[model samples]
Target: MREVAFIKQNKEKWLNFEKAIFNQRFKNPDELATLYIHIVNDLSYAQTYYPKSKVIAYLNQLAARAFQKIYKTRRQETNRFLYFFRTEIPMVVYQYRRYFAYAFILFFAFVAIGAVSAAYDDTFVRLILGDHYVNMTLENIENGDPVAVYKSGSNWGSFVGITINNIYVGIRAFVYGIFGGLGTGWILLHNGIMLGAFQYMFQAEGVLWESVRGIWIHGAMEIFAIVVTGAAGLILGAGILFPATYSRSVSFKMAFKDGVKILISTFPFFVCAGFLEGFVTRYSGAMPNSLSVAIILVTLGIITFYYIFYPYIVNKKMTLHTYDSTL
Candidate 1:
C-alpha cells in the first residue's frame, strides 16, 4: 500500500487515539496499550516504506506520545495489577471470543462420544478412564463412597499439588499451539472423554448425582480453565496458520503474546478450583445435597459471567466511549 493510502486509512483512528490520550478518556491502561500497539505498527510500516516522508515523522511523534501517556500515568502498581484482571484480560477475551466457542464445541463433541461409547460397552469406560482409575472407583462404590477418591489426601497437600498440576496442564494446553492446535485439541479430547466415561461409570452404578455433586464442586472451574486454555492454544495456532495482513512471524509473535496473556489470566481460577477440590470436594459426600449443588452452580456462574458475559459488557462500554469521543 502507498504511504498516502496507509495514512488515509489510519488517520481517523490515530486522531481518535490522540483525543483519548489528551482528554484522559481511556477506560483503562489496556485500552491505551491496545491503541499504542496499532500506532506503533503503523509507524513501523511508514518508516519502512516511506523513510523520508512526513507521515513517518508524524507517526513517530504520535507513537511516542502514546507511549508517554501509557507509562507515565500516576496510578500505583496496585492499580496496575487490578487493571490487568479488571480490563486487560476481559478485552483480550472479547477479542478472541470465537476461539472459546470453537474449543467448547470440540470438547463437548468428544464428551458426547465418550458418553455414548461408555453407555453401550462396559469396557469402554475402562479403556478411556484407565483400569487403575476404574478399578479404584468401582472399589469405592462397593464401599458405599463412590467419590472417596477425593478424600485420600491431606487438605493443604492436595491443594498445593492439585494447584501446581492444574497450572501445568493449562500451560501445556497453551504451549501445544505450536503443533497447529492439534495437540491442544488432543488434550481436550482426552480429558473430556475421560470425564464423560467416568461420569457414565457412576451412572451405570446408580450414583451419577452423587458423583456430580462431589466432582463438580471444583470441576466447574477446572474444566472451564482447561477449555479456555484450549482456546488460547487455538488462537496461537490460528496466528501461525492465518497471518492476515501481518507477516507470519509477526502474526505468530502477536498470537503468542495474546495467548500467553489469556493462559496466565486463568491462574487464579485454577488455584480457586484446586482449593475447592482439596477442601470442599472431600466433604461433599457428607454435605447436604443442596449445598453441593449450590456450590457447583455458583462456581459455574462466576466463571461463565467473568469469561463470557463480562467481556461483552466491557466491549459495549468501550464502543460507546469510542463513539462518544468521535462525536
Candidate 2:
C-alpha cells in the first residue's frame, strides 16, 4: 500500500484521536492504546518500505505527542479501583465478545454431553470423577454433608492454591491457542465435562438443587473466568487464521497483545472466585438457603450483565460517540 493510501485509509481515525487528545473528554487508556496501535502499524510499515520517507517523520512526531499527553495526566484518587470496574474492564471485555461466545458455546456443549452421559450410565461419574473423589463424595453424602468437598481446605490455603491453579489453567488454555485454538477448546471441553459430571453426581443422589446452591456460589465466577480465558486463546488463534486486512505478522501481534490484555485483566475476578470458593463455599452447608440462592443469583446476574449486557451498552455508547476505542 502507498503511504498516501495508508494515510487516506486512516485519516478519520487519526483525526478523531487527535481531537480526543486535545479535548481530553475521551483520552483514557483505551483511546491512547488504540492510537498507539494505529501509530505503530503505520510506523512499522513505513520503516519497512520507506524508512527515509517524510511520512515516517510525521508518524513519529504524532506518536510522541500522543504518548506525552497520555502520560501527563495522573489522576490519583481513592476511587481509582472503583472507576476501573465501572469503566475499564468492561471495555476490554466488550472488545472480545466473539471469543467469549465461542468459549461459552464450547463449555456449554461439553457440559451438556457430560450431563447426558452421566444420566445414562450409573458408572459414568466414577469413570470421569476418579475413585477418590467419588468415594469422598459418597462418604459426605452418607454423612448428610454432600458438599463437604468445598469445606476440606482451609480458607487462606484454599484461596491461594485455587486461585493460582485456576489462573494457571486458564492461561494454559489461552497459550495453547497457538496450536490453532484446538488445544484451548480441548481443555475447555474437559473442564466442562468434569463440571457436568460433578453436578450429575449430586443429581443422581437427589441433591442437584442443593449442590447448585452450594457449588455455584463460587463456580459461577470461576467457570466464567475459564470461559473468558478460553476466549482469549480463540482470539489468538483466530488472529492467526484470519488476518483480514492486515498482514499476517501484524494480525498475530495485535491478536496476541489483545488476548493477553484481556486475560490479565481477569486477575481480580479469579481471586474473587477463589476467595468465594475457599471461604464462602465452605460455609454453604450452614448458611441459609435463601442467602445462598440470593448470592448465586446475584453472581450470575452480574456475570450476565457484564459479559452480555454491558458490552452492548458500551458498543451503543461508542456508536453515539462516533469513535469507539475498539477501532
- Can you give the lDDT of residue 198 in candidate 1? 80
Give Cα distance to truth, residue 261, candidate 2, Å.
1.5
lDDT of 2 by residue, 273-325 (tens): 89999889988989999999998888778767877788668545543332334
lDDT of each: 0.84, 0.78
- TM-score per prediction, in order, is 0.79, 0.74
Full-model lDDT, candidate 1: 0.84
Structure candidate 2, residue pairs in collision: none
Best by TM-score: 1
Per-model tally of clashing residue pairs: 0, 0
